[model samples]
Target: MIRILAFVLTLGMLAACSAPPSSTGDEVQRLASEIRSLGPDIDPVEAERAARIAYSYSAQLAQEYEITDPPLVHNAKVNKGLRPRGLCWHWAEDIERRLDQEGFETLEMHRAIANADNPFRIDHSTAIISRKGETMRDGIVLDPWRYGGVLYWSPLTEDTKYEWVPRDAVLEKRRLDQHGALLPYVSG
Candidate 1:
């Protein structure tokens, strides 16, 4: 009986995720305000456009991967490397590349490293953005990998959920260029 119920619930979620992306960019001013609320001095217009771009990319990826099914759990253990949508890094990397291409004049996006620091635990990856030249700690975490295709965001400094270490863009770029190379300075 429990399995049957879970199956039904999963089917419902699958239906929901197949629906079109929620944001049509029709409410640009409203989205801008929402972005501003997350951080001071952010150009809501740019943020909104960037956000919409990310959302579109995520939605397309989710559809391609058939993750529109949503999932029984948002937990990492369950969501592990499921492919196309697997791994938080995939989402972060994909979105980061897209945003990077668009170019945020006032915003600086950084590869945020979660301070897992434990050998037993793996480091979680995500991307963040801030006013150019502003401290990365005070940036906005754009975690689009979690919660299915839903984007999760929070203040990097006040979140307290994860201690983050940033990599020098130059070295980090070199590290990523290696492809399958270890992330420098990450303890995990």
Candidate 2:
């Protein structure tokens, strides 16, 4: 009974993923507007270009990654070596790398991690865009992995589902945790 229910749900998800994704013009515009709103100094042209590249490149990645399932399902496939790449960090890294090519003087790209301190949930990574001289907290989250390549973007403070922290901080903490774990406990 459990196996049959799982099969039905998988079929439904597969059917949902079969449809070709639509153009991202409206999404691009909305993202551009949000990017521009990051600060008064943000360049409108750069914002638009970044938004366009983010959405288009994400779609390209979706195809390259052969994303035929939801985010978690695709993650499982990637973990199982059934897919080459589609992980959250892959999305963040690829998007950040692609965006870096533009050399936007008024914009900065940041990487963040969430759920690093939570034992129950997996760590989530994403790229963020902010005005020059600002931190990730003042940036907008550009998350393409949330919906399995469908870009899910929002302002940093407004993204309620995840409490993001700087990527470096999380990595450093993880390193410390591992080092501590490796040390033998001394019962004094």
Candidate 3:
């Protein structure tokens, strides 16, 4: 009886551990919807242009492809002729520019060098935008071009380190930020 009970318990634990977290497709769809809703609230002309650009690139990436990173996917579909990894920074810069043109106060930040002792450098950028006070938390969305996903704000102080926000954490942060109406967390 003891052996059987232990086996059953172990099996249950394994099943739980192996289960996948939230689907990326559903999360992306939610973020897309949120962006669309916020579009009308922005300045009309700029909003239209920005929305068109974001939507167009997003759609292109959704087409059949093995790539998953949003920025990379966008670049690949739009510029198929270019070598892989050639347009990472270019796409980020383009997104930053469009967001700025849309009248949303924007900021671009770059990751610091790995270490003085090491020759390697880290290349990543994040965008921050200002929105109505009521929409503060949801204001900052990290569209990691190399990683095709959106991350929302959390209680992430400068000290909290993470390569990427877990999908559940991203969704929770989105809700909390939207609830509190606090500005997006920005790191120097």
Candidate rank order under lDDT: 2, 1, 3
**Rank by TM-score (best first):** 2, 1, 3
- For each candidate in turn, give its C-alpha RMSD to the true structure in angstroms: 8.4, 3.6, 15.5
Cα lDDT for residue 163, candidate 2: 99
Candidate 3 accuracy as TM-score: 0.34
lDDT against the true structure, each candidate: 0.64, 0.91, 0.41
Give candidate 2's total backbone clashes. 0
Error of 3 at 68 (Å): 7.8
Q: Record all residue pairs in model 2 with backbone atoms less than 3 Å apart, i.e. clashing.
A: none
lDDT of 2 by residue, 1-188 (tens): 99978966875675466343465558899999999998898899999999999999999999999998887778878998999999999999999999999999999999999998899788999999999999999999999898888888889999998999999999998899999999998899
lDDT of 1 at 111: 79
Per-residue lDDT of 138 in model 2: 96
lDDT of the structure predicted as candidate 1: 0.64
Cα error of candidate 2 at position 38, Å: 1.1
lDDT by residue (1-188, candidate 3, tens digit) is 99978865764554344322344554444444444455355444443454455545533433423344334334445476543432434444445565555454322222211122234423334343333443333443434343442233221222133333333454576588778887767899
Deviating ranges (above 4 Å) for candidate 1: 1-31, 37-42, 68-82, 167-188
On TM-score, the candidate that comes out on top is 2
lDDT (C-alpha) at residue 75 in model 3: 48
Candidate 2 regions with alpha-carbon error over 4 angstroms? 1-25, 183-188
